[model samples]
Target: MFPFYFGYFDPTYIMLIPAILFSLYAQSRISSTFSRYLQVRSYKGITGAEAARIILDRNGLYDVPIEVIRGHLTDHYDPSRKVLRLSEDVYYGNSIASIGVAAHEAGHALQHQSGYAPLSIRNSLVPVVNIGSNLSWVFIILGFFMGFSAFINLGIWLFSGAVIFQLITLPVEYNASSRAIKQLEENYIIDDDEVRGARKVLDAAALTYVAATLMAVSQLLRLLIITRDSRD
Candidate 1:
């Protein structure tokens, strides 16, 4: 199916080149923006952990524990555990990027507190998305080897969970960024200039999610096209 998917068009590699290049460009831009923000010191000089704490407190979510995990950009919110895990850099650094990222995670805590619809939906999808992401490729490969249409269809359905998760995640991420920026401004955690830097960092990070969603959708479309052509 993989080969069949690409074999239908003349110079199929050419069609993929643009998508690959665009994905790369998006990733590069996101990285560059994050790097730039990481260099900019927050005007208030608050550490990332402190910023997260403040945001959570402001949202009446003082119960959410913030912890430093050893990794780079591995920061995330665990809804099930009611914890915000920050990377080593984000937990300790006072850079705009660190604070912005921390604040965004805290926004998730706030979302949980407020019962935000998108965040709720995203949390609901986590289990299925995890299973789907891990098993979809395996099923796809097995289906191809066995020439089993049922297995292939099942793989497609499983993979679709990942695509749905990506789509649902876009709003969750964007809203988190929006909440982060607003909280920063409202609490005076960052000055005007620093807020601008934080905005850049959050915006750049959001693009990464957008890129992932687009890539997933592209692959799903390719699979559908291949499945259709196979029938003919």
Candidate 2:
């Protein structure tokens, strides 16, 4: 009998396997999609930084600063700093993938400007998620060993904040990608073929987020079941 392989059959880890596999697949898909589209130059020849500038300026968001950051797929709009940071590749790329990603960040900027509800809520939950992420498992382990129902419940409650945040994030992410595609089409940033390619990239990127949410849900469920069994 294989000892490590038997871990998969354990109830606690059983629910986790699907999410882990999905996460791996989604990551691979996004990487492949980005790599494929990165080589396909857009007809407009607009760099990602340029695309972000155009989208922001078009929407009267000229004050938002764009900073070039290092790393792959690290592009993000920092609402607190009023800065849109693009990864080295995205910042300099003049391809469909670049424009698509830039436009997606621009959409987030627009959401901040317009006071998008879900984005605001997600931002509010950030601190709680950070603190809870650090302490949730500790409380769970302590409570289980100490036979303290209160501690176990508190741990589950803390982790639930992260799950809720992830659920809200799905809409925020999906909407951003949708807005990016619409802006790309209306503004003629990409031709039909390029748009299709960009969409594919965004779609693949979106799946990664979905995978993350699934992973969190799985963990929360595992904790809940453990706590319930302990109580019984």
Candidate 3:
């Protein structure tokens, strides 16, 4: 039974193949898309930090500070800190890709300001999911070895929180990108042609989140199928 569920040749592994492939594709797509647009400078000539500042101020989030962090593409907004962080490439570069990524982070700040429901929910799940996701497999494995279905069910329930967190993240991310595009357009931060380029970069970024959600759901399904089979 352990071999059936946990061994290298476990059949349940097949369920994750599609999601794994998609995750790889999403990573490559974002890399290539960002690299391609990184070469194309925006007509506005403002740095990514400047672009983010403009958006934040426009939305009356003038108190939120933007910080430059050392990384490749690690731009994000921290609602708790009320800060926006951008990687070196995004914070200093004047390329369309840079501005787009910065705007996306600013969009997240906007979400925080507007009390977006999905963002609120995702944030609330962060602590619980962090703990549950890590220990869920332990419980499942322990239950199987001890012949305790209750432990297995508890593990599944805990793992389900991670899946729910991932699902909620989809809308939160999508809304941020949408807000980014809208802010860029409405503010005339980038030209019309540049908008398309920025949108391509953002759309590619969004795919990574989609791939993650699919992978999480596939994992949950695999666990459910395995548990049912073991019961029979």
Candidate 4:
């Protein structure tokens, strides 16, 4: 039989406040920095999709496709499809923010092309992470109510997959940003001052990932502590 559960929140839930605060800070930082940089357009007036194309072509990744998707900051590189997807604003807007985002996606294409080890590992874990993300909470919640030790343990183990994925992602994302900044500078995509603003955008964006990883770790630890206390 399935277990129905409620009322796990307690003093330990307060531990999550810091992570929540950091998440909010990251969101605000990225938004403000992106907006500020967007106001300072590039000398060349090149759009983000154009920047992405330049990066791809410069890196001999001309075969890689670029597509504009409809959304806010929905840019990403799809390794499975071998395509770079940029948000509508980035695809058409000629701003530092747009170009930084586009180049970052291009950097992912470079990682895929160069066979980056972390990216490869991250790609491999995608399936397990998907499964864990979808089912871990269900297992944890049900196990807690039913006092099923095996189920709780299984759930925690699965949840760890998410933490691991987040950890793996940190280095991958930073490296991509690094590559993007370097490419932007060396290719003369943007002026020196504009490069700094572009880096600010990328750096702020990275903070969100950092906050996410911290939150995941804190949540997992809190759950483990709760389970231990319950067992005792």
lDDT of each: 0.85, 0.87, 0.93, 0.91
Give lDDT tens digits, candidate 4, residues 75-161. 999999999999998999899999999999999999999999999999999999999977998888788878898888989999999
Please give the range of 10 consecutive residues that has the lowest summed lDDT in model 3. 1-10
**Whole-model lDDT, candidate 2?**
0.87
Give per-residue CA lDDT, model 1, range 122-216, as digits (tens): 88988888988888888877776677778778889999999999999999999989999999999988888888889888888887888888778
RMSD of 3: 1.8
Q: Model 2 over residues 1-232: C-alpha lDDT tens digits?
A: 1112213443676788899999999999999999999998988789999988988988899999999998999999999998999998899999888888999999899899999999999999999999997788788767866888888788888889889989999999999998888888887777877888889989999999999999999988887776676567
Among residues 3 or more apart in sequence or in different chains, the pairs in candidate 2 whose N, CA or C atoms overlap within 3 Å are: none
The RMSD (Cα, Å) of candidate 4 is: 2.6
Q: lDDT-based ranking, best first?
A: 3, 4, 2, 1
Top model number, lDDT: 3
State how far residue 16 of model 3 sits from its true place (Å): 0.7
Colliding residue pairs in candidate 4? none
What's the alpha carbon RMSD for model 1? 2.2
Off by over 4 Å in 3: 1-8
Residue pairs in clash, model 3: none
In candidate 3 the C-alpha lDDT for residue 66 amounts to: 98
